[model samples]
Target: MIIAVIDGMGGGIGGQIVNYLRQELPSYFEIYGLGTNSAATSVMLKNHANKGATGENAIVVSVKKANAIIGPLSIIIPNGMMGEVTDKMAAAVCDADAFKILLPISPENFELVGLENKPLMLLIKDAIDLLKKEFNIK
Candidate 1:
């Protein structure tokens, strides 16, 4: 399956997700890192994503072929990630055919309801667990 990890800014959260997924998932599963900028893409690529692309167009085009999409919840909000994630990118990701696994990592002025303030690692683990459940992986 093709899994896409999307992120912006420093790409720290996305990098962690890619690293965990690379360690946990089988080699056959392809991980695509989509970033709002080259810096984010670089971080994810370093974490072992098979391929990576940057900018709104790259994200929009890649999401079409993704089996699953993982990233911060802010990725879906227009102008999120301090304006790194554009409206077009948010629209494409939300409308993609992939199953979205969004972390509850809130950006400034955006918060998810009923979610406790957990560590980033824990939130990422939840995302990984969701992937395992969706793919029926042990």
Candidate 2:
């Protein structure tokens, strides 16, 4: 399956997600690192994503081909990632047919209600668990 991990800024979150998936899941799955910038893409690539792409156009094109899309909730919010995520990128990700597994990591000036303030690592672990359950991974 083609799984896309999207992130921006320092790309820390995407890198961690890629690393966890590589270590925890079988090698049969393909991980695509989609970043708002080259720095982010490089970080995820170093963490062992099978392939990667950067910028709004790349994200718009790749998200459609993914079987699953994983990223912060901000990915679908236009002008997110400190404006690194463009409207077209947000629209494409939202409109994609792939199943979206979004992390509840809200950006500055916004907050998501009904969710406890959990550590980032814990949130990522939950995401991985959800993926495992959905795919029937051992």
Candidate 3:
């Protein structure tokens, strides 16, 4: 299966997701790191994503090829990631046929109510658990 991990800014979140997924998922699964910038892509790549791409166009094109998409909640919000995420990118992600596994992390001025404010690592672990359940992974 192809799983796309999208992120922007420092890409620390995407990097952690890539690293965790790589260690947990079967070897046959492919992880694609899609970043808003080259530096973010590089971080995901270093964390062992099978492939990497950057920018709006890359995200638009690559998301269609994925079986699942995982990232921060901001990835689907227009002008998110401090404006690094474009409307086109947000639309593309929403329109993709892939299942989305979004972390609760949001941008400034955005609030997700009723959800526990878990640490990033715990949030990521919850995402992985959801993915495993969806795919029937052991």
Candidate 4:
């Protein structure tokens, strides 16, 4: 499955998603990074994204091409936090009929685990474990 992660200026969330997918999916899922700028793309590419594209159009294109998408639920709310991921991207991901595993973070969820500064590796592990039980991923 092709997995796309849409992120903002530095691709922090997107990079974490890519790393999680790589460690947990275990089937060589094609990872694509959709960054709002060059910095975001660089982060994902370094973490081993098969391909990457930048800007709004690039995100739209990834949404069109991918089989599945992953990110925070707030991504659904366009201007929620990351200006890169707009409502259109959220709608596209939802409407694409692709499997999505969104983290339970929301706009009002005041405590955010900053992907850069925090050890989200354990969080990702726990989420994937729960997802495995729910979806039987292994």
Each prediction's TM-score against the native? 0.97, 0.97, 0.98, 0.74
Candidate 4 lDDT tens digits, 1-138: 687776665668778877877778866678888776789888988888899888766776678777666666666666655465677766776776656666656565455565433355665565567656655668
In candidate 1, how many clashes are counted?
A: 0
lDDT of each: 0.93, 0.94, 0.97, 0.70
User: Which residue pairs come into collision in candidate 4?
Assistant: 78-87
Across 1-138, the per-residue lDDT of candidate 1 in tens digits comes to: 999999999989899999999988899999999999999999999999999999999999999999999999888999899899899999999999999999987888865799888899988888999899998988
The true-versus-predicted C-alpha distance at residue 119 of model 3, in Å, is 0.4
Candidate 2 has which clashing residue pairs, if any? none
lDDT of 1 at 69: 99
The per-prediction CA RMSD against the true structure, in angstroms, equals 0.8, 0.8, 0.5, 4.3
lDDT of 4 at 108: 58
Colliding residue pairs in candidate 1: none
Q: Rank the candidates by lDDT, best first.
A: 3, 2, 1, 4
Among the numbered candidates, top TM-score falls to: 3
Candidate 2: regions farther than 4 A off: none
Best by lDDT: 3
TM-score of 4: 0.74
